[model samples]
Target: MPQVYIVYMGAQHASRYPTYELHLNLLTEIPVNCSPSESLVSSYQRSFSGFAAKLSIDEADKLSKREGIISVFRSKTLKLRTTRTWDFLNFSHSVNRNPPLKSDIIIGMLNYGIWPESKSLIRDWDLRQRNPVANIQKSEAVFDSEAPLVTSFSSRGPNLITPDILKPDISAPGIDILAAWSRVASVSNLPNDTRVVNYNIISGTSMACPHVTGAAAYVKSFHQNWSPAAIMSALMTTAKPMYPSAGQDQLSYGAGQLNPAKAVDPGLVYDAGASDYVQMLCDSGYNETMIRIVTGDSSSCSSSTSIGTARDLNHPSMALHVQSGKAFAAKFLRTVTNVGSARRSKYKAEVRADRRLNVVVNPSKLRFLELNEKRRFTVSVSGGPLPGNSTAPATVIWSDGKHLVRSVMVVYTDFSS
Candidate 1:
């Protein structure tokens, strides 16, 4: 099947040159599936000069070489709450809260399920269980608690699926969330429980997921062209690491708490694409055949030029499962593309970890000459494999003084259940 692409043209020159018309003419030559009756230009053209069009892989590559075309990228699907969350993030009351802008955005939630009666959802949600929790009410849920503490029940991870990569990438306010509920459902999913309410207090990663979804939508409202990975990187890199409570580790709160305000302008992002993830699976011992089964594409590790370990998957957080009770050494390579507004920005790395762990960042200094420029570095961590599943948590931060890009690193030994 043909896929959609977002075509971006070079900067406007003195010559207007009927740019829009030229783009349409080029599309007309391609073997597109659009009906002849359809107005391709009128319907597909974007307001910002970029146009979305469905074309075969070869057709897109062919168009990229055309004159005035700056770049062509495949348009991929991006997938995202009440958000009395403004005050929690210190948002100004003067900020515009227009329904028109909100209606254009969609925040996706996956949890035990949402109660339809909650006023926050406004009876405007679709309940679909063709495929796919608990009871925590407001009185028992604290509203103003310092977070980044993984809810006692919020699942933490050694990423059973892939131990090299961190799981639960970030945390958000999940406890005592007052949102719309299902009038047909009980407060808890227990078969014996028959309590029903229009709005109920809830908590868990499911609740946390929606909060982050709203934060992501908030970020997308500011940057429409950002990919899903970029949005995730923004949230992960800009997360707050302040310890909300004791015993919080990378496994507990991957990159830290969700900081929506800071995410809008994350200085740099560790971006990845479909191929990057395919390689990650490859490194996780998934052979080319198995990889195809998951990705639904023949793009196998054999053909992919950029092969990387699961730890080097361009993820915003790093978690390594070290051999238990034995000292170990590990190194993680990461690349960050400059996304800040400055023309030239410099960053220095600073690490904070337990005294037993020795962490070092090679070439601690990074200088980006232009926007979108990427700089790569390696973080070497040693002195791990602590007793049992005990984790040695550390933070690797790249700061340009104006923006702090941080990644949570955890070196732990698996404790068998």
Candidate 2:
């Protein structure tokens, strides 16, 4: 099947001809503000308005109808009269109608800077609406909790209300990540193209999500039977929360960071099947008809919803969010698949709270699976005095029996209280 790529077009490049030349110049002038100045705001409005005026309504509608095209513009406050009313809805419907091309995978390319827009949609869909059909419960619980707060930098959820849930089910490392860029696109385009190899550092959960996606691809290549839901479960349950050291403010590092190896071998993963999401929607007040509409099946309700089980609540994405708070503590979980054999491993956690809060894993070990087998684990803030509001540096450490696998910084701030 033809691969479908979904790229977010932030305000910087919302126009049709989003050339790098224009983007760079715009970047230089646009001030980073919650509410931009009138002149700048007006300029943006004029630019998009002009762009909209140039296109015939049909053409604009057609562009919006393209598969994988969704609104990634930030600030619901912005007046995107034409695009929001029709263009966006058209795009959403088109993607919903078309099945993925017979490709081995679907890749979604997102820019972290586009998060504000993404989150706006999610917040509205997941939190605001009642009788919603998407998995808003998980997101809602996470949003209310203090843990990481869904990386203020990442986009929010409640992607769409009907015809298959489309919220961001999980997160990945899309912040300050080093990735390859196209030299032709980076260098040949106007200003500041000095770097070779076309490599650049971009941040956002967008960077993080791709890491998980790539790992999922690897898993799929080996195990084709595993469904997308399974892959998502594995990734979500296996994530780690990285925090800053004492005397620091909460930084962007969330869930400690992504661990591909550990994720691949997580012992237990919080799974969310289709019915689980359906039930979550139901709990949020959706009825059978709403579920059918959201799941693209208006026929009879599936039996999965009839047999209520606690397993349905197993969602690591929600779990981590519920556990970790903003009080200078970080927590995350890992997921692993059962390759062939099941092994038991002893896992231990230790916390060092002082000038900085440090968590270390002891015996750094798990015993399961053969040479190529995998298992999952969860690391959390088991014990620690909540940090004061004053900014401080914090540290998180993960160690295996023989080696220190990773360390992350947790930044703190005293602004709120």
Candidate 3:
């Protein structure tokens, strides 16, 4: 059966080459005879170079093997994870605002919905399509006392794609979020329902995403030159740690709740550039060609590596999964760049783990003379054969009196894997 498949070719290398023609040429090269032009669904040339086309599973597999092609996978139906947002995060309106610079940061995401004549998805309304909103009532909003608890819908991980890397780097307000609504679309999305409202409450990963995006932009407003990784580190390091409860494991809330105020001054950040990620992919067993498909870079991986390979990424969090019935020992190397306000800072490492897990950090103390000064450390986690479907949570905190840079670590023993 034919299905729409998206071909990923990474970032475009040159402007002169027409991506549409390139996509067609690849299609024509398929063993089966077919009109390449007719198969083309659309060319994604604006941001990155790729194309969508209707193809069978075999054709997609064949296309994935093509040169310059990074990946070819069938496009699946997307489920919108829906958000109470700001106040719950303790980021109230009273917080500092830097709108002029904040406006410059663009978070490009597809919150795809009906695009009315006006571009704003939020309050710029078109009442012509529905009954006029009755009133503009102003009132104090009620709060969810148990605000930051993990919703059942949130994704859990010892990341399947790359188990070494923890998924959901962080969490944000994503339940019962009152965001703007499209007047033309039914509020309940029911065919017979004709009700339309200016705003509607929602919950999901999508809602959580915007909350984090806004926090990132907020963090950017303060540190205009911070990289995505740096900003992420700030957020993760300064986050309020969450404890696992029933129905929740260590992987659940990532680096915990999104704390916008504290993120601005993370003190130390595990800054990573493209090369670091490239190295991570390399460690994850991706070849040179596969690396280019994802990164559009020619960086090569060497055999000389740290205690751990993919797990060594200068990431804000660390995770490791082992067989439930087998004894496991793993070491991870991490580097942190001082982004603190103080010119000279001293940090001490603190590791907290379960009785069943023995965790140690090498060079438990670090000293930095100036901003951007980097320090590297290694964490060794060793434990006995744990029972199946179990997890042990641990924390590594690097603190310098004023700032607490925390990294969450989890060791899972999953026989099912």
Candidate 4:
């Protein structure tokens, strides 16, 4: 007999009932044999096929990371496997132990799962099994009306020791999404072959991660030679901020929704190399030993890693809030490489200051860099020299003659010394 591996993919909670039922229906459609092993294998294939039918490759990748889904496959008979349960603790530990893998197709899934510590406070009160009256009371106890409901569900920062910064280097759609499911799962109440719909929506950083992953896949499919970092840079440079939803904060969406078409041909990408990240840590005040520990080069230490003075244009340490007042100055240096044509052209750097703060650009014009050549730029901010504490954001937009090239955020804070 040959080895077989089955993996399940998608969010774990029964809330994804529609998707589960779809997978079950797929299992029923597969041909069965007398052998139990073969039958089980058939069932797994049917279930995965059902999921694949409903999702693009990118969506499937996102599903694999969620608690309930199995993310990898290894079976002699199967060419590609899906939906085996993942060991997240082991997976996290393994990433620390090994270097990154080299592959032709690298699919990056970004989900902002709530901080494990914050889960108790923000667990969904509306889950079906909870007593409705009791849950309503509990909701009032846990959250205030002004507090955005779904914002906390986004993934957290200080991704400890992951090779790449754990944050959503970019954002996408992972929220109350409707897709395929398994019919046989007891939790799914829908009939097989029926396309069940989960109309109630969900929002979290998870909802946002897949949108960018799909875009990355699209870019990889087209530009097969690009590195993972390059692909990430392209997506970030070209991402758009989500328009203000009825009751959402800008922080929740980061740069906003993703535009894959724009990402594929970004006029210029803000590239960050390994050394750049190292320098960022150093500028932010980390010693060599501390840098090694934070970047996963060494074991954990007692003293906190210092984030000194320098801030990367894209560093996660800085955040701007509309109401808080704190005065600060930060600089971000970026190297922009033009992958396009060599013709010299004029490029302007524009800053779209949020209403709460004033921003000034030192050298607003960017000189042309030849194709394959790189250029560096710097930005600085002060919180309007106000009397009280306040904060706002400057959307630093870089543009060529035709379209906006890239936009990075400079968050301002006004805190008294």
* Structural similarity to truth (TM-score) of each candidate: 0.69, 0.38, 0.72, 0.51
Clash pairs for candidate 3 = 81-204, 82-203, 82-204, 83-174, 83-175, 83-177, 83-202, 83-203, 84-175
Better of 3 and 4 by TM-score: 3
Q: Please identify model 3 stretches exceeding 4 Å from their true place.
A: 1-84, 92-100, 110-135, 183-186, 191-198, 297-308, 415-417
lDDT of 1 by residue, 1-417 (tens): 777777787444444555455556767766556631232322222224556666778888987887767888987774312336666655555545455555576656555565554545624434333442225343221244654356555677878888888887887878767666777775654333466787777765667788788789988887766788899999998887756246566777788778888898999999999978887887778887888889897867755355567898888888888887788988899899999989799999999887879999998999999998999999999994478857878888899999999888878887677
Question: Tens-digit lDDT track for model 4 on 264-326?
Answer: 676666666666667656655567688787787653323454443344534422343222333
Go through the candidates in order and give each one's C-alpha lDDT.
0.75, 0.39, 0.80, 0.48
lDDT of prediction 1: 0.75
Best TM-score goes to which candidate?
A: 3
1 or 2, greater by TM-score: 1
Q: Write the per-residue lDDT of candidate 3 for residues 1-417, one digit (tens) a residue.
A: 678899999987775657677777889899533567667766776557888888988888899998889988888885443223555566757656566765667655555432444334436555555766647545555655565688766777868888878877888877767666778876654333477776677667767777778788888888888898998899888887788888776678887888988898888999999878888888788887888888776677766864247888889998998988888999988899998889898999999898889999999999999998999989999999989889888999999999999999888865363
Compose the digit string of candidate 2's lDDT tens values, residues 65-152. Answer: 5443353222233322221211211112222112332246654554432333343345634556666565422211112133323444
The segments of candidate 2 whose C-alpha lies over 4 angstroms from its true place after superposition are 1-171, 175-206, 244-254, 299-312, 317-340, 343-417
Pick the winner on TM-score between candidates 1 and 4.
Answer: 1
Q: What is the TM-score of candidate 3?
A: 0.72
How many pairs of residues collide in each model?
A: 10, 66, 9, 50
**Model 1 alpha-carbon miss at residue 89, Å:** 3.1
